[model samples]
Target: MNETDAKVPVDGSPLELALTAWREALGEAHVVVEPDALEAAQTATFATTQRIPAILRPADTAQVQACLRIAQAHGVPVYPVSGGRNWGYGSRVPAGDGSVLLDLGRMDRIVEHDEQLAYLTVEPGVTFRQAHAWLREKNSSTFITTIGGSPDASLVGNALERGDGRGPHADIFQHVCALEVVLPTGEVVETGHARFPGALAAPVFRWGLGPVLDGLFSQSSLGVVTRMTFWLARKQPYLREFFCTVNDDAYLWDAVDRLQALALDGTLKGSFFFWNDLKALSVTQQYPYASVGRTPLPDPFRDQFREGFGRWAISGALSAPDAEIGALLERRLATALEGAFRPVTFAPPPPDGESHFQGVPSEANLAMAYWRKRTPPPQAPDLDRDRCGFIWCSVALPFTGAQARRAVEIADRVPRLFGLEPNLALLAHSPRCLYLVTALAYDRDARGEDARAHACYRALARELAQAGYFLTRAGLQAQEASPSVRDASSEVVRRLKAVLDPRGILAPGRSES
Candidate 1:
């Protein structure tokens, strides 16, 4: 057979060929090729600050399949993006190298909401807020949701990237039920038993029956995830959030150990996070529940607001009956706070009183609140004076007090070389799975800021990689700066690409050169 038939066709006019194939394979409304419209569509997604891709909108799975087939035939790379709101990570935009950006926003749909099973099946275009709003509107009081940095972020994208949430089920990756993917070969595959005969609606607990493929799509450019199902947390009757303060930096690791133990033993119902004083103030703005605008803590507790206070706070929920909640709280507090310094517990105040731990709006959560205050706000922090970019380095460290302390030391000192303070956050995947130490450096935005920020991040990433720490999500400069992890990750990714997209099409330069 000639090359055209042996493989796919690649000789015709690229744009004409793609448009024609799309028109025949999909409806007219699915294709967009206007230059201005394409640029606008590409920029709408996150993480495309420096580099943008050629935009392609596919309305449904057939369109996606046709686009992938044409790209594979013509050796054109394709990057699939969902909500385009992947922040801090490479965002939804593809890394540069001239690829066809497969926009999934057009496929937004909620395919299934099994209230009895407590799971939601949705397409990549579905956002967290949209899903939550749907659940509320449906009057399905059976499920509660845990969302990431922005409610606008795509549920499938976040889960595929292993994003975390502030609930008992912290890791989004762990909650994945099933996936509907359009692969590079123009074939649509449904993972999990939904594809099996007589199991169209099987519960998604049969991974052991075959090689698990759900994980491959995560953090990979192999395929476009059109739909996914994930488990949701059950709504509780009574929930409470509490903020705990630790005065000494020395006790930070101990506090984490205690918190982890509590979490593992079911003492802590919700997620717990630790932040330094700088991050705390940056997050809350109002310190110690006191200031001119907000109620102020008295002078007796003034020292708590001081710098380097090493704040260890947790939001706890009491889900059981009244009799059980009180007893559970007492036991949990006693065990979790044992032998720690005078740890102050700030619970929701009574009626008409200032409660440090009110059921604050969901937006008041730590991560979102911090970003709102510190990240490029409208009227605050002259970007010229307080201009800062972040080089995020995170790793799965061993879960021990000694290891945590050592990691903290490394986290603290890594940023000092650049005259920046380390902004640290702890992510507990499970009771004993992995403790992620995320360190962020503030690079003042000035002339040649990109180069400087890139250099610092490269150095930090290289050092961590050399010490046997694997980066969860590498930054843009990771390949040039931190060759250890980047080189290894790139190699594995290349091999996977060859097997999945042998025509050198799907996200070409993303993995293999």
Candidate 2:
């Protein structure tokens, strides 16, 4: 048999043997072998980017178990696709060689929603929109749930990949309460409180009885997540939202510092992000002040505008009564904007309301609304020259503004040192945890975009490794290429793979061997 050919029993009876075993293990209707069905199952959010080899849509956990059992018995590789909407990351397709896609889109259902406890349990295939709708129906007054990527993205996939979003509850990993995973050996295993016998209705705790195995599954090429439960922040009594622009070059660090202070001091309650002028212009056709019918800044006034205005915005309910929301906002704004850019305050549009500042979705707003005007669909800049592929490099550093400034300085100079333009996006994960530095290479499809991006990435990866910057899953591929960065931690992760997935069948092409 060819090396890439699906391994089947040698005797002419092997194919028959496998088919009979699968049918007996799962009902005939649960097995899909038709070419069109396979093709449809393999479709992904970023189909324009990656290629999908084979797709298997199992009807239930039993079918999934049967499929995996067959794959392992035959030495076939399995790539689990929960929603297939992980756009920039590997998407929903497998990254390994000679792999068969295992799609869980069919198992989508909200298992449970405990409004009294402020938590929801859902399957891997549940989309953010579905979860949001379920939560709205269950508790109209519940706090806004966290969401990542697009509304169509899967909640389980987002949580497993540690997706980030806006608001105080943006860190999805922290919100994860429990998980139901299917091990590689075709057995179902529940982690955390769900593991204990008769503990179905027990309180959700991410870590408890023993070592946390849930963390191992996250970003790992091991088990597939079938279900998960996550805690949601309860709705606060009062809410306030505001946007601050920093156009002056000198205030760049000042802005980072103020935002960091507010977040650390518990004043600002949402994830904070900084956008460059180019990125800012891409999102809004009219400046917030100008769009509201205020006097427009003259062209000569442009130079006075901060070089890179950090959209230092905050979103969260106040701990105090409704009457105190305004005072809290003013105090937070005063401390965060002191000696920095001019602070502008605005009320959050009603939940059903909209604002150019926060109403539009951030990710889509940046990808579609902002850049689409200058470049048409599929017209992203080339990945070579002035353009480099963006990598998410989040490092835990001091919470002070100086640390944030250093991060920006490194982001700017590092790309330029490799002969690429400095186009970086900064996001403050939390006041004390880590700072996310996203280096944007010009879109590779754009003219003269290829060479610089590749070279810059290679160079930047090496520099970051030497600088002791720990890489997250977002940069896992790039980190593997650097010797300095691939250490014992990564080695142990690999060894864990060999033990959990002895057959090397799960997500075969994604991480290093």
Question: Local distance difference test, per candidate?
Answer: 0.59, 0.58
lDDT of 1 by residue, 1-513 (tens): 122212222457664566566666665665554455444433311123333334667777877888889877766667788887654555544665556678888788988877777778888888876776777678774443455355667888888877767665667778776688888998887777867767755455637358788877887778888988877766554444555666666676777777777767776655566665545554555233223222222334434555334444433443433546756665676567655444545344244211112111143333422231224343432222233344456676765666667666666666566544455666666776444444343333334545654665666666766666567765344546534433576677778778888886766445322
Candidate 1 local Cα displacement, residue 56, angstroms? 1.7
Off by over 4 Å in 1: 1-16, 23-53, 206-208, 285-323, 338-346, 349-388, 437-445, 475-477, 481-495, 511-513
Candidate 2 wrong stretches, greater than 4 Å:
1-51, 200-203, 285-321, 352-363, 366-396, 414-423, 439-452, 475-487
TM-score of each: 0.80, 0.79
lDDT of 2 at 14: 37
| Candidate with the greatest TM-score versus the true structure | 1
TM-score of 1: 0.80
- How many backbone clashes can be found in candidate 1? 5
| Each prediction's number of clashing residue pairs | 5, 31
